[model samples]
Target: MKPGAVYFMANRKNGAIYTGVTSDLIKRVYQHRNGLVDGFTKDHDCKKLVWFEMFDDLEEARRREVQIKKWKRHWKIKRIEEHNPDWDDLWFDIVK
Candidate 1:
């Protein structure tokens, strides 16, 4: 199976947040940023990669995604802040 990742995207530094799971983090985030995927992220323009974590299996990544998505906003925000204090778009970092 393909490697998997759980990630977060935001509209801006302190804006709407979205959590997702993907077998290809780079490609999936690219699709969100470029509006290639039509859904909440596209509708809200949640393009900034605030955070991400890799997993050896897709199911594990997906389970984490679901759990994170259900978290209280503050908890999720704190989690992201811990990983990305600056809340920077990590796309370039990952792609390069």
Candidate 2:
């Protein structure tokens, strides 16, 4: 199978922003949701999956992650709003 990567944004139950990359989107997100991962997300309660982009190539995904990381807070908010105007958590939507 070709490698796939996802860059996702999470906010504290309703605050802050956390960006992350994962080859296994579902599992990684699950870890964050349950506080199984350490550092940023866990401490900040950044479990909501506000936005994500998928890529077939790891390098492309990495590049996108770097770009997003460097973006201004307003740009990131705009990016998320474009795809998820409501800023709703998308985790449950995927499994259904």
Candidate 3:
């Protein structure tokens, strides 16, 4: 099975956030950044790749995605800040 990743996208520091899971993290994030995918992320302009966690398989990533989705806004923010205090766009990291 393909490895998967749970990722967070935000419009800006402390701005709207979108949580998602995918087997291809780089491609998925690319779609979001380019406004290819329609839905919450597009509506909220949550295109900045702020954080992510890779899992051994898609099922594990999906489980983590569900859990994170249930978290309150503040909790999500804390998670992002803990790993990325500046909330820098991680696009370069993934591409390279």
Q: List TM-score per model, in order.
A: 0.95, 0.88, 0.96
Q: Please give the lDDT score at residue 85 for candidate 1.
A: 92
lDDT of 3 at 74: 98
lDDT of 3: 0.95
Clashes of each: 0, 0, 0
- Superposed by TM-score, candidate 3 places the C-alpha of residue 53 at a distance from the truth, in angstroms, of 0.3
Q: Lowest lDDT 10-mer window, candidate 2?
A: 6-15
Clashing pairs in 2: none
- Supply the global lDDT for candidate 2: 0.78
* Angstrom error at residue 39, model 1: 1.0
Candidate lDDT scores, in order, read 0.93, 0.78, 0.95
When summed lDDT is taken over every stretch of 10 residues in candidate 1, the lowest stretch is 1-10
Most accurate candidate by TM-score:
3
